[model samples]
Target: MIGKRVLSQEPVTLAEVKELTEAREKEGELTYEQTLTMDYCNKFAKLDKKKAEELIAEVEGLEKLSRRHAISLSDLLPSNADEIKLLFSKEHFVLSDEEISKLLDIVGKYKG
Candidate 1:
């Protein structure tokens, strides 16, 4: 831990977290926190890695959406404009109705 340094940081979806933790567990042992995170992700992650990636990409194409927002949208897969609005409530920008509709359509495509 002392020698290791982070080269970069990026937000990731729950599906990515689930995949990474699973790979790490297969390689060796996971810490308690890691184990808990794996369990949580297993239970809560709505999309698989591929679907999450696609969702993130499509969501990111929308104007005003950041990577963090895209990842959050992928993780949550909000079904309606109201839910999407709540997700963006803390953000500085507001989404127009057309943008929200587009987001809903994109999410609907991936959501099962």
Candidate 2:
């Protein structure tokens, strides 16, 4: 099969964002989109690699959440319920405070 175009509306983890941006960088020059992706990746890179992975895992563990929402959480690694709610706004689902705390607990475990 030939190459397929990816829809950018979906949320992707910052790790994936970084990987894709770096690959594009090696291919010659970064496109405007690539530059934006790299910029956000750095901006949201508050957690180290392991902690980021934990955040992803935490977000994925929540029930009633779509994969896009989970990846968005991993990308932002937000520390509070408000930010999580904002990320889930387009997802059409609202997480409860207890659930938000659960995710925060998992992410907080790895925050050094």
Candidate 3:
């Protein structure tokens, strides 16, 4: 817990090849050759098939994307938390009550 890693602001570019042809098809109108190529690519490629297929149909649906992460966990919490006593009892292998209380105290700082 003394240190943490961080990511750079700029995104790394993926290699553009025959693989990205499907992504281009998803973006706009696909030519006859492009359609045939996409079909072949989908048949042979051993990649994230579900995600790739979903991405093909998913337009620039920012309105839905923007609201997707709007819901907050704090909204579901009750004023009294005794009902949810052991939030992560099975997740961790703590040895003592003092250690568990310390863990909870540290976890309390993360609001969202």
Of the candidates shown, which would achieve the greatest lDDT relative to the real structure?
1
- What is residue 21's positional error in candidate 2, in angstroms? 1.2
Candidate 3 per-residue lDDT, tens place, 1-112, comes to 3586665543111112245775786789988887787676555443243432333223113222221111111112212234223432343342354543433343243322
Candidate rank order under TM-score: 1, 2, 3
Off by over 4 Å in 1: 1-5
* 18 Cα displacement, candidate 1 (Å): 0.7
Best candidate according to TM-score = 1
TM-scores, all models, native as reference: 0.92, 0.67, 0.25
Score candidate 3 by TM-score against the native: 0.25
* Candidate number that wins on TM-score, 1 or 2: 1
User: How would the candidate models be sorted by lDDT, starting from the highest?
Assistant: 1, 2, 3
Worst 10 residues of 2 by lDDT: 45-54
lDDT of each: 0.92, 0.70, 0.36
The true-versus-predicted C-alpha distance at residue 55 of model 3, in Å, is: 24
**Collision count for each candidate, in order:** 0, 0, 0
Q: How well is each residue in 26-76 modelled by candidate 1, as lDDT tens digits?
A: 999999999999999999999999999888888888789988999988889
Model 2 spans > 4 angstroms off: 1-10, 47-54, 89-92
Which pairs clash in model 3? none
